[model samples]
Target: MSDFSRLRHCMVDAIARRGVKNARVLEAMRVVPRERFVSEAMAEFAYQDAPLPINEDQTISQPYIVAAMIEAAEVKATDIVLEVGAGSGYAAAVISRIAERVYSIERHETLARAAIKRLEDLEYGNAKIIIGDGTRGLSEHAPFDAIIVAAGAPVIPEALKEQLAIGGRLVIPVGDDQRQRLCKVIRRDATSYEMIELEAVMFVPLIGEHGWAEDGSRAASNHKVGASKKQSLPAMIAEAAENLPDFEDPGFGALFDRFADRRVILLGEASHGTAEFYRARAAITRHLVTRHGFTIIAVEADWPDAAAIDRFIRHRPSDQQQEPPFQRFPSWMWRNVEIRALTEWLHKHNSRIEEMEGRAGFYGLDIYNMSGSIGAVLDYLDRVDPEAARIARERYGCLTPWQKNPATYGRAALSRGYAECEKAVIEQCQMLLRQKLNYAGKDSDAFLDAVQNARLIASAERYYRIMYYGGSESWNLRDTHMFETLQHLLEAKGSHAKAIVWAHNSHIGDARFTDMGAARDELNIGQYCRQSFGDDAALIGFGTHSGTVAAADDWDGDMQVMRVNPSRSDSYERLFHDCGKVRFLLDLSPGKREPLRRLLSRPRLERFIGVIYRPQTELQSHYIQAILADQFDAYVWFDETQAVTPLGPEHHRGMPETYPFGE
Candidate 1:
């Protein structure tokens, strides 16, 4: 066979390995000629089991994902299929091999025209490409045996569903833009449809009248309130702010009562060093713990360092007393006056309650500490079981040479000169987990911490190693680790236990609605929590129109009180500022006002200031396009804000601004 033919067979085999059982789907993929559907520059990578950019910022679905969707649809030789968001006509071409006819819709006229020529050149006689909104399926080809939507939808379009023939299947990616689950809706009878969730997949947004608007401009226009009459935004904002309860008002607690049943509440900060964001989150958390029975306060801090604060808050004796937690770079993030006050309150609250039930615990959900986590695992094991500690020490000894600088290990591991430590770390973690019951009676919490640390050591090892081979994979790995930690925390705390998450907006906000998410293929804790807990997880984001923020121009630079530029005229912050409230919250729940929905659904610039802040390049580095209403269930806006105050003397001065250390 030719090279391209061999590659095609390999791609089909890979799809089959992913559990695509339909023989027809596999055969169709095998004969599709994927190279013909992608740009000439990308043809070399056509057989790779991943999405490739086509035209108009669109992507040809991964071969495996396409096979999975087709298999789920259960297309037959006599069937007619309707394919939506047909960028390159690749998926439709594959469907044509299995179905009698395929009607593909592309909103981009250029792409549709190109796809038609490509399909005709390839002689895919059964397939036809049309230029129009895919959400409104081609009505001329009325009842299709199957409908496959290549792009994600906020809600499954009624038009597409109506176009499905009785006993037909509709396979689509359903959910918000950040992430979606592959869903198959089978028309059981004329009046009923059976839905099954297949798996998670990410795709470009479907843009049309029934989907997301073509661009932020179009989105803004569609959702613009009272377009004919120009009303002052600041005046409207001021009026709205008048209705919000005071920060300390007991009545504000009622606003959160709706979320009392939720298992997780992820609170996001648009900028890490904003005082109002921290204070507001603390106030909300105090209420959740005191009245709503929240039992955990997890933040975006490294595990070993945050463990010190956890010990202090739980009133457990610890070696961390001599030094506070958060000694890492950007120490001011958690070692600030605002966080100190919150921790002090947690200590007092936990002290007043019994050890078992009512006392809430503090934990860290980040995995940046490679050596610290390993040391923690070994230290815990030594106290619980010396022999097990000896075994762990021996297993981890393979990594001791590079413990002082884990990146050295990351580099060395990639070369043949160094031995692979992954197996050793995995074995150590597995042994710890397997022996959990043996050490449970001695100290359950300690044992749990040790096991979690062991797991962290294993994950951190892989994370560091992957960071060396740069890509968004490292980002995804970190967030996945955080999500797993949250899950473990909930499982250990008990089924009814609720928690509050404190993380940067990038980590806590749903990534789908932002440009960063599309570029990196990143998924944050907010997206995962939403998918896992659905309505039982509430994501709240905090923002400020303009304020003084504590940040540095570069990593490891001295923290300075920086002036935050005012929000852009086209940004969400501007809208909030115009609302005229000094401080207020807006609920974006499904049943909220249509005006609010319209305002939020429109894409607008959202600021995201991290540890490193550079005002000169703020637009490129700190701003992202986001549909605020779709990104979060609610938003808390501080019209003006001040910087957070650091709690103690800075110790990170003169630290080398080197790789794997500053980030």
Candidate 2:
């Protein structure tokens, strides 16, 4: 056989050895051209079962791991499979042949772009590549038939569980850094799931948003392939807490100072659409920027808006100049809370924006119409055909077509005459509108007129500065626009200058941690920035406090909130509940407070019954009167020792339950 055939046979054998038996998966693997997905130098090893290094420190998953995961998932030909790691797009391409649709994510720009090309070249039309975090999963495309994690994680993430379709199976390596076992968890029903251990395997640690941290990754590597869960949560927490770096402590203020007397770039989370969040983020960004010589501010708005910002900087009229505009800004209904808040904030800040320009001409980091450039097209379409415009508006307005919905409005537009040449009038109107919206807002005649009157430097700047933000999709364009904006800042604004990126967490969090079987597998701005700046770039995830409710008004305030009662992880049948308070033990040392533990290993009582304590009622002063009436486990508290111990599963039916067990 030829070299290619030999490699294919070797790959198949490796996959079989891994216990992957699905015929469809094997055939898909057999037929797909892996060599095309890799570089020429490594084409010889394309069919190897090992991961090959790719650009940006990313690697394609080993072929056996990929096949085992796909087979374990039982991906049906009709099922829409969500592939979390689209490193080389080889796995996605193979799955594309077996699954109805493949939504793959990659955080590295080089990998994402490469995957897009490889998949496209092979005519994998069923596949769509998105550049976003996958750890959160594609909530918009909730109910995926299968989800395959390309990397190993310390635990099965909560977000992925929520995103799984009913009865869907998720194949992932779930364990500590020391030892990880392939765990296949099936969502048995809405409220429950069944877990089955598959086999032992190893792979690169998943690094994205919810993946193991560097410490956790290190811990995993220290253990053997299969280690038992031997440590308790409190012990582990204490160990991790004690071993953390000094920078994690309050004394690390000096490091912040060392970074610079330069400027404070306070970033806010804009992932959720609540206007309160954006306002909070903007206010924080402004306060920090203003306090620290941050004359030039930036946002994810369009280039035209950026230009308008420049005009504001130069004290020029904005109404007549159409180039710098808020074309991508959504003006539709108020259903999309995030978009609504963003638009309102954009409008309300016009005066503040003017002030910012006066301070130091704030630039729209996203100078091109990126994510919603199509929204600009639709806005222009409205002027030409009002009826068709209404349909398009309804198409996107009612549903967040930008999400991972099966029937996206953009896809529909492509199917209809909307994307064809037959709609010449509409198409021309859109083209002209986009041109005006994205550029300096001049017509053919006006542009020439301005050119004839402008200085050489001005004309050259306009020509050099003019940029486009469109690519694979609206979302993808938005990211590319930010990257370009960063480029412009590094080149145009000057190097060593600081700039803040205002985008979703998906764009900010490390891709290795965040992007996975997600709706869109696009490169995050953080990933790009890190590649460019190395340790100079840092990603701080804005995570919500679990078991607490944060109100909208609390954005600007600080409050110590209560946490859910703590519970042990081992026993599931305990009647113990979270008391939602921090108990202080009298005998404990200043630095060593014992974590409260449950008295029993399992639930001994059939059920817990309670009664209202009233002044007039019998046994009102007896805290355990009911428990004394019915024999039950007695809890004795020693005030001096600051300790509580369980008495017993005893019966004292007719008496007030007394603290029989004493110090």
Candidate 3:
């Protein structure tokens, strides 16, 4: 037999040897073309007991491992299964032959499309591929009888475990890349599970909203397919962001400046560790509102938490209520006067005011306690219908964040909206339980198994929707409301609307601005502004101090920005000799000028600007290191800096003036 044929035989032989006695699973494995899923170069070794690299840095799972996991699941023809990390959809296609239906999720768009094509070409009609965060799982078709994870994780993702049907099995590789254990977990009942170790295995790290941190690393380079020379940084960044549309980028700042006169700027500082950044956030907010006539203060507080203050605002509280519970001071009442404190002198004022520049006047959006956010929305629904609150909590466990919350459900009711969804799910659960009563005489244990499985599938279906789309609606609703509120305000005053959103740097950077290989397709605010407001919006990202100022105490008022260059000769040679390597020349600020010049003059200045020319992919790791105060630079990021760090140094790439900033 040919090597490929022999390996395929080996997989089937090993599976049978390992006690994978299912005839259907073995038949499915024999017919499926594993060679088509890997790269053209690796076709000769397709059936080997090792993962093969494919396009977009993904891998087709090893043949024996795939066969073994499939066999372990004990799938039947009537079973519905879920496959996470559906690379090229080869394994899913295999599962489709032995199961009623298969739902798979892939985070990378490239892999998702490729997998879809492979399945379609193979005529796997019962399999579906979704391009979204796999950590969230597929909700539209929930309660799968089995789920298999192809990637390794640092921890057992709770969301995935919740989606399994009662009596369903979940097989996943859990641990870091170097060391991992394949774990098969069975849901014994609600609030209980049985886990068994299968074997040790190695796999690529999972990256997405719920998996490991997609920390914008060198890891993305592993996906290299065909490359002549390294692409330009700008082209790489734009392509990565455009390819991945989840995170927002603020690269479209120039487009937004047109609406500068109209945008309402909101600011916040929530985390106690990064509270100082709020001072900068507030200072910018105050500068805009005071100088530009922008009005509106929104605090990130629960309305129910703030309603007592609202009663105080209207002077409706009883006389014996000496002070509002949320208030830090009794004298600081009214709006614009205290608003300046939050916007201008945030660091010196109360953390709440320093963090939140809005004083709840003309408009506001609250996101403090997520449960409170649900409650606030529920209060609105309750005013519309008294029973809405009770149904929401009992049926959907709709009060808190979806990842850890509880639920109630059925199959068809799974497609409805929140209120209707609750009624449908509860009714379905009852119907399934009723069916169990008819079969109780056969085996009491089996009858209870059906009841438990029915509820399991129902609950997973309900919880899946909440995780996939419900939590997302909270922010989407806020933005939609903001848009409507702005429209109303503009209509009333005969004015235009402008908005400045204060969110993480992830929300603002234009992915188009970064190298595609750096962050591997993250969406940011800049992308949304372009899509949402089009040419009318500007997105400016604040990123410099975020990675550098490690802790509250590391910074002093007298700190200056420092510029340095990496001493690696390869980078120097690339800058001076190579035509392909791009250089990112930056002009230093007044704060950075002196420190940079002094460091450049010293031969052993590693004590200050220890590392320079940091690989753009390592930015997030640097960010975490900076955040933890583990002893790192003042700032390390991919784009936007006070001092210049070149991809490769070329003096001509630097700005015209030697000393651009006046001392």
Candidate 4:
């Protein structure tokens, strides 16, 4: 096979691996000569899956996205298809291979002429290019079997919908100019239609009667902006954001050498479920562990869930009957493929070392799993002292009633007759501390585990009770617990302990620089670490412009791999996207015009996606005000990313049926 043919097959194979299972769609992509549409200089990149810049500032869609759209449209050999905004004619060429005929429309006459010539030269007589407004869609050909739009439109054009044949599929990107989702609309009947949102996509504005204006007056898409958004900022950021090699590349670890000496390195993710964020954090963490001697790996997870992982990683024997890690809702956060790889690597690394203290330990810093912690404490005490176990069981019995739904206890406490159980949980924790010296000598690990569980129960009790009151009290208490937990973990490892934290950007970015602290007085672990560790803490945040994310529509809901709307035009993620590199690491540490400080002086809206994502109210739910220059020491950028591969429920071994209180 020729070079282009080999590259085309490779691209087809990659798209197939990413879940595009349609054999005809894969074959259509494989047979198309993508290199022929672009100029000779750009031919080398023609077969790459990434979108490539084409004529008139337009971008040819990524090969994977094109394949995905075609597969979603479900085109057939005898079908007649319509393609809007055929910039390079590549997608139309691929479609022509599978469909009987293809009619492509383009608003730009120059692009239309070029596409016509390319199609004719390649003997793709089945495809025809027309110079006209694509939004009007070619009414001459009354109805099309499948219509695919390249650019993002403000809304589904009525004319295009009217032109779809009965049972025809129309795939278009619909949303504001800054963010859009690829939606497949099917004409069910004369007036009925079915719309299914596929994934998030970013494309140049579809400029016509039904789309954005010519001057960008209708652009920006209701974005939140700062004082001055000089166009130079994005370019300056792109220049300063250092390019990074693939995560597994040796050079990728060297990029983090500047932060190797910090006592605490907090790696953050814009959303809980992007694969790149987890993989990137893992790479830097491995570098810190192997090259810099960082021994503690703490995360935003429950103590009991992570304890199971800790034992597995540190080569400590555990009861065969013990529950597996991450059994609750949103279990995919820690039970994903990327995390599984990290744990496997850590376990191997720890096994190579003989001293237990010298090996890196994985731990959770969040306050959840009160019932699990109670069970673990009782189990620990039972093995050491049966008397203490009985007393602990009695003390924790007060909380057994609310084990299924601890939030109800908070409401119960607010009522006139109910009493708070805070005192009982604390007294039990204090007793455990008092006997620490006596029990620790027997097995330091066992005593520490039991004591931490006791401590967790006390904190969780107060957390649940105050959560009902709302405001920042509960938020502050949670962060305090996390910070205190980190301190205890570090202290247990000695003054030489160097820790790495994995959490959402909201929990790791310095809240002082954002409205979280300034407006609501909501303290987070990032702010606490900065106050405690001072210059010894390095906070790095990760963000993406457009991609897929694993999220749920509601709390405690089933996980769905949903589309992450592109960054709002006025958000920091947009600026990073404009930087033009597919991915990079931008140093935002304070200095004299260093780390692009001048370019980032103004405050901008930053996107923060947690476990739950409600796209309908994304601006209000996800965006926050923050001065990026001070919010983090560095920012890792990925122009586009995909959702994490979530493990099946089989991974979650055993858990109490009433293990509620999942925060």
Winning model by lDDT: 4
Candidate 2, residues 1-663: lDDT per residue as tens digits? 777876787678656654778999998898888888777766866775555656664567667777878988989988987877788899999889899998987766778898999888888999988777666678787788898888778777777877778989888887544345788889988889888998755455666667754433323235332221254433322332211112223322222232234322323231232233343344434443444434445554444344443444334444341432432222111113333333333344444544433343345544223223334434434544566556545433432332232123334544442331223323333434354543334333223112111111122122222211111134444555566555555453345456655554445544432211011234556656656765565443221112322121222232222221222222111111222112111111112322311212111111110111112121111111011101111111111111111112342234222211111
- RMSD, every candidate, angstroms: 8.6, 23.7, 23.0, 18.5
**If both were scored by lDDT, which would come out higher, candidate 3 or candidate 4?**
4
* Ranking of candidates on lDDT, top first: 4, 1, 2, 3
Cα lDDT for residue 149, model 3?
86
Poorest 10 consecutive residues by lDDT, candidate 3? 624-633
lDDT score of model 4? 0.83
Q: Relative to the unseen true structure, what is the C-alpha lDDT of residue 471 in candidate 4, on a scale of 0 to 100?
A: 50
* Per-residue lDDT of model 1, residues 106-220, tens digit only: 9889999999998999899999999888888988998999999998777778788889999999999876634577899998777888889987666667777776675422231
Give the poorly placed runs of model 1, Cα more than 4 Å off.
1-247, 252-254, 320-323, 415-417, 649-663
Query: Which candidate would rank higher by TM-score, 2 or 3?
Result: 2
TM-score of each: 0.66, 0.36, 0.34, 0.64
| lDDT by candidate, in order shown | 0.79, 0.47, 0.46, 0.83
Residue-by-residue lDDT tens digits, candidate 4, 181-209: 89999999999999999886656778876
TM-score of 2: 0.36
Better of 3 and 4 by TM-score: 4
Question: What is the TM-score (0 to 1) of candidate 4?
Answer: 0.64
